[model samples]
Target: MVNRSQNVYIIAEAGVNHNGSLDLAKKLIDVAAEAGADAVKFQTFKADNLVRKNASKAEYQTRTTDASESQYAMIKKLELDEEDHQILIQHCDHRGIQFLSTPFDFDSVDLLVHKFNVKQLKISSGEITNAPLLLKAARSSKPIILSTGMSTLGEVEQALAVLAFGYTEPDSMPSIEAFHFAYCSVEGQQALRQNVVLLHCTTEYPAPFEDVNLRAMDTLATAFGLPVGFSDHTSGIAVPIAAVARGAVVIEKHFTLDRNLPGPDHKASLEPDELKDMVRSIRQVEAALGSPLKTPAPSELKNISVARKSLVAARTIREGEIFTTENLTVKRPGDGISPMYYWEWLGKTAEKNYEADEKVRR
Candidate 1:
């Protein structure tokens, strides 16, 4: 069970996939909670406040929707209002799961901090360069989780600098509340300061297997002295479970009601059933990662004799004959000399006659 006991905190990212429908959004929450996700996350943003009316969409965004529409226009249509927030929060309560959201604009962050009582503040990748947003988020003093996709080490370092020391006055440095990282590489962890958690991630939507580099998660923890995790963009549940095996403490993935839905994030997002499977798999893996001890476990101890081997006589040996490899071998029912004592038992005189397949005693 050494491999299965690690718990990966799974966050079901319901980013703008509700398609401006509160009913769909509530259903999404049900899906997340029912899937056993530790938390359900939504994107809190005002289209006009987050980006200029003329700002364009990312390439992936354009591919999913009409290329001519502005990113603001697309988001504005998909915006979740105050009423929606109230309902979603209450729905999360009813569903018995933590409610979380990533704020894209200053007002959205303030609203989440003051109105919803959100336990954790999530920083999306685009905001890594937005110093103003980072400062505001830091001031709220909530535990922060950062997405470092599309950022270089220097960019991450700069973001950390803004949070760690740059936000305070020139003469007074303030202590950050909490900092956590999620990325596609171990190199990203170098940009983090002390007390940070690094999560393995891939920037690509529905990230390719070759780009995962999951082993780098342990490398981050070992090299940077911090806890590690994963932010999966892979379309399936298998990668997240695999990541937990690599020692991920966090698991964040996009989730929506339907993959066939008409939204930029829907195609790569997990449907309700798939999200459930992902959570169940993660929990199962967590149960499996047990302790690291090599000794027999309490439960496994009873099977030791039945499963392990002990030294035994390969053939009948008359009393007073010296023990040799020709007459001694190893077999199960470990109640006699261990195979490790083979050398000591070799060339020794037997005190009594030994039958074939009988355990060898000192």
Candidate 2:
């Protein structure tokens, strides 16, 4: 969804940290806007449509939330209705930040793209295999950010094939072969290039550092030949900043009004100040990743003569005198002949007289 001219897009993922409170959600919007995030993202889904009532909570979820509550029950409480979406969007508009949400089910996808008109759609890592949902998202024609986590390259490719099919939707019946055909077709590839951005992610809350595999971002770029970014779940701002350095075009990280707030994602999320630090650090890294050419930067050009060496007289010498090893040396103030000609200048007649520590001329 980002143009080539734009800096790395940073998304402050407020997620379910609002804990079913509209005031808290609006406050999160304010925090993200104040932090200078490109967008503030929330999770939008009816828990009934997403998970079975008896579905178990994930280990990380259980640790952060009440283990006694079923996954559906916990998420059911976090569900943001249509009115909630409108309120959050208006809040985001007032705060001057884009509003985004991850759609976990078919209706949620429709709600985000059709009703609310979000600029882009973010497909969760868990939905990478949910072909129906992926197809529905792709069919909407909105740009999609697909997260690859707890999955293999092959799985990511398969998900992409489904998306490709949805985007190019040939007249044939939907099937694995049709999806493969679409993936192999020129039209499907072109559609993907224009509308999809892949995100490298690790599917764990507070994911381990070793498991991050930031290099996988490169692999995703190479293998898929699409714009790639990162969905960070690690403990701090460092990894995401490093990801930007490594050429991630977008960075999405979870944030909360307060870490100690009783919610599933709060503990793994950055607090307000930490979120600000993260956005500032990411912008700094983006600026540092300036040009690919290996040459002196504009700021360092003036320092070259002062810092580099040039041929100079080691001791006093008369005009037309023979330049010798003992009389010639390399020194600073490189406006004179470069030290590379030290051997050539040796034993040659000096064009002009020079004094001790003076720059030698041809």
Candidate 3:
């Protein structure tokens, strides 16, 4: 497994939960930093370019947002312009947390790259099929974490191909020869690909536990030979923390200042304390996994005498008499002949008189 020194990258995706208010957006950043998240993420996009004017809302999109509103109209209200991006980034800096925003289209990718100075990039599930968008982001040379929700295996392969072929620079992965450097999504089906991580996710908002198929995340790691993580849409901290125990290297969960906030995602998001608890639980689990060796620990050997057994005389025995099963047995205080020697000692002549319950010496 690739030992990623960057502790679990806990990204609190505050996507559109600000309800189109810049003040609320800054408040979300404060909550993320206070919750100890490594990054606070937003969505950067131009509504007109993001969706067709007539595109319908996703079943999830229709629930918290106005069903009568076209997807374009709904998204327009949530749009964050260049000024908003700059202010959010500066707010993140002031709060001492990294700011990240997923760009939904080609132009937004350019804006995030040339204008926002993002250290890492996130590709939303919807864009997993957007090869041109993936290519634009890949050329920027920033590391990318791509979400694969509602995508088929074949589509992911095509997008990954664009990233791999478009970049002229050599990859930092040990498998790649040393040369130049460029950015790529690192999204292939290769098991154990050190640079890539697969996130187990259910596309449903407030995803049902049964559909999570968390075991598939393990299957992905085993089948692809890469690190695996979880992108949780479940309503609480439990599922994400459980994913960490199951070997997730990264955990991306939605966070908003209040779950009651009016937005498509707020109802499924974690409040500040829950986000903190999730991160802390994940770190605690990482510590608990420890070394796999099974030998007695330094703290366990001292109890051996009190916990194990030794061979002892069960009844009084005369000198020169034969040792019999009735006269010998195993008991605690393990400094004498082990009980494993029972058959060998059976029927042997006794060297001396022995008292009842005394440890027997060979």
TM-score each candidate.
0.86, 0.97, 0.82
lDDT of 1: 0.78
Comparison by lDDT, 2 against 3, better one = 2
For candidate 3, lDDT tens digit of each residue in 106-168? 888889888767776788878876766766776776667777777665555555555554444
Q: Candidate 3 overall Cα lDDT vs. reference?
A: 0.77
* Stretches > 4 Å off in candidate 3: 1-6, 169-195, 222-224, 302-306, 313-324, 331-358
Worst 10 residues of 1 by lDDT: 176-185
**Pairs in clash, predicted candidate 2:** none
What's the C-alpha lDDT at position 211 in model 3?
78
Error of 1 at 45 (Å): 0.7
Alpha carbon lDDT at 269, candidate 2: 95
Residue pairs that clash (backbone atoms under 3 angstroms), model 3: 190-224, 191-224, 191-225, 192-224, 192-225, 192-226
From the highest lDDT down, the ranking of the candidates is 2, 1, 3
Please give the distance, in angstroms, between residue 216's alpha carbon in candidate 2 and its true position after superposition.
0.9
lDDT by residue (tens digit), candidate 2, 192-252:
9999999999999999999999999999999999999999999989999999999999899
